[model samples]
Target: MAFGDIVQGSLQDFVNIDRFDTELCVFIHIPKTAGSSLSTELDRMRPPYHNIHRKYFYGDTVTFSRIEDEIAAVIDSGALADARSCSGHFSWTLAAPIRAARPDARAFTFLRDPVKRVISDYRYSRTPTHPTYKETIERFPTIESYIEAPETQDKMARFLMPGDVRTPHEIDTFISTNYAFVGLLEMYPLSFNILSLLLGHDRMPSEHKRKTENTVDNAVDETPRLRAMIAECNQRDTVLYDIVRHKLLTVRDDWRAMREQSRPAA
Candidate 1:
């Protein structure tokens, strides 16, 4: 067969999965990376084929045991019989169980600059309205303390590729092998466009209509020292973000071209 025929066949298979297959698309949401907004919009943007979608937000309040129970129930009850997509702030650990339930699952996640993401996380955690505000303030009395905390270190790196394997090369390999998409928050509009294509959407969602507007908490003073501390602590995440950025830049034109080619003739 010609290479063009192979490409067309592959595109057809992809569309078939989106249309008829009983598979799940898992979104591994990294915090402060516009995930919540995407999660909200995804529900609205969901095509008719995937009407039974679910979103789960993993956090201090939602423990692994709780997730295991929920997942167990979902699987046991055959809830995944129909097409579904789920977004969550959980680690890659959930991938195994999810796939066990639905073998054809595909995963994707977003990454952001570690320094900025950490700063945004800290400031947001300080808000009185934030559920974890009290805990955050109590645990991290200062930005320095927050930056120095063990939990704040290489968060994206750890979350994206959990287990003993860590180095920059390994994380890159893991993402390449596992994730269908690795979006960068810095280039969210383009990333969203690409995401729409991957999910069989004709167009990207508007940036203005966010499900949840996660603004940077600008009132808090971000001094040079704090920025340096964040940078130093999240070196691994910085590397991962750079990898995602490069992937985005490299694939944009090609993906657009393929989408155009894959479209039906007028």
Candidate 2:
């Protein structure tokens, strides 16, 4: 199944709250990356004066769905104090719709190591409710086999096209340009701390600070077949991972230096 199928019911009315005071923090949820848990924590930590609504998209359409209409209705109702803080699983295309709908909003997203992400996704897809799981696994002997399969490559290409099939650069550009913060799921604590500092919130709670259990039980190894498949299936993600990884390291180093400088004299 594609990403949009999971959401149920008319989320429109539910998301239309108006009272908002915090900076509009949009969590661009990539699939299977602890989004649900993190969003739950964010809900608890959200300021009383802010209106935060969590939503997930259903299809590729750019126009406002029933959900978007609900958001508009809420804003019109003046329930939010300052602005709306909306977070959910949406494609990069949703950026324009959001900006048009709420001009004062800022966007953020988190990404995982693509190989691990794909594995977790494969496990989650196996659920009976997932529309594409049976078809996907039926074609391959193992998750590794599936990764190496050309058809699997095509499937991933279509699902993660960023903007669409034609705009190959859309996703990267969106990350580099629009997002106020692009978090690394591997270094989640640092990412969360950075997010909190950037958004001017206090630290995230201890319960929310830990990583989620791996959805897949695949063992990590460097077998030749595994290596080859990971090398191929992860080429784009390798580039993305390196860039983001470097950025995280830089941020860490800078933070450490700042802390050292701020230390009281001996």
Candidate 3:
């Protein structure tokens, strides 16, 4: 719990004050993995522009036309505590552009079980206000038809590669290379602790440490076709999930033991 004198300033002064430094931390915010909550906490901890504007950028945009503009705006608006550190739900392709713009930036990301994530995404995609979900679903006779359709593939491709047109190999490469730290959502406290260490904080804010919402309960009755569609839709995520799970398992034995020790000595 000893956070050295790395940061020299009052916490209040740190918040909402823009100051750019040579070394920066880029939080790669993947959707639905407690991203919004974490971003809020980071915003409170850092300055306003320090948290990247996820809403402003169109997720479909392939070119980096607006990234430079946003960065410049952050610099001009004095909303960034450190111009080097930018956090948002951005594509991995932004790595080169970010580095070119700010060479000293380090990146981090959080991931979760792909099946659960996709189910949550589906639920969120459907809203009383937004008719896109209804329209998209209506276009297909069934979820299976939607999954097998070319449009689904196109959408998935675009989503997976937000800033660039990437092949499967390229996508994997981008993720592995760009991210400095990849925390698994299943290991909640450990993930937060790791992120805190990376951010040079003693502990994560208590407010940020809550259970996730929008989760799909296993009790929900899903048809075989629907299940198949869901699985197919999230196949790539499944691969990524397995990779992350394996990596975490490699280093989690000690953490597991510590957790067990902390439990009531029954």
Error of model 3, residue 260, in angstroms: 9.2
Best model number under TM-score: 1
Q: What would the TM-scores of all predictions be? A: 0.76, 0.63, 0.62
**Which has the higher lDDT value, candidate number 1 or candidate number 3?**
1
Count steric clashes of candidate 3: 3
lDDT of 1 at 264: 88
Best by lDDT: 1
**Residue 161: error of model 1 in Å?**
1.0
Superposed by TM-score, candidate 1 places the C-alpha of residue 36 at a distance from the truth, in angstroms, of: 1.4
Candidate lDDT (C-alpha), each: 0.66, 0.52, 0.52
In the range 1-266, model 1's lDDT, one tens digit per residue, is 11112123343443334331234677777777877677766666652222222343457662233555566566676655564676665678855787777777777788888888888777777775465566677788777888888887887877778766567788777777677777777878767766675666656556452222243432457788777878888888888888778766665566567667768899
User: Model 3, range 1-266, lDDT digits (tens) per residue?
Assistant: 11111122332222113122235667777656767666666555544337555233234531234554665566566544345356765555654566565666666677776555654444544433223545544565443454566544323223334545355566555555555556677876766654564565535446653333332221234666666666677666666656556655654654455446556766
**Residue 164 Cα positional deviation in candidate 1, in Å, after optimal superposition:** 2.0
Task: Report the alpha-carbon TM-score of model 1 versus the true structure.
Answer: 0.76
Give RMSD to native, each candidate.
6.0, 11.0, 9.2
The lowest-lDDT stretch of 10 consecutive residues in candidate 2 is 1-10
Ranking by TM-score: 1, 2, 3
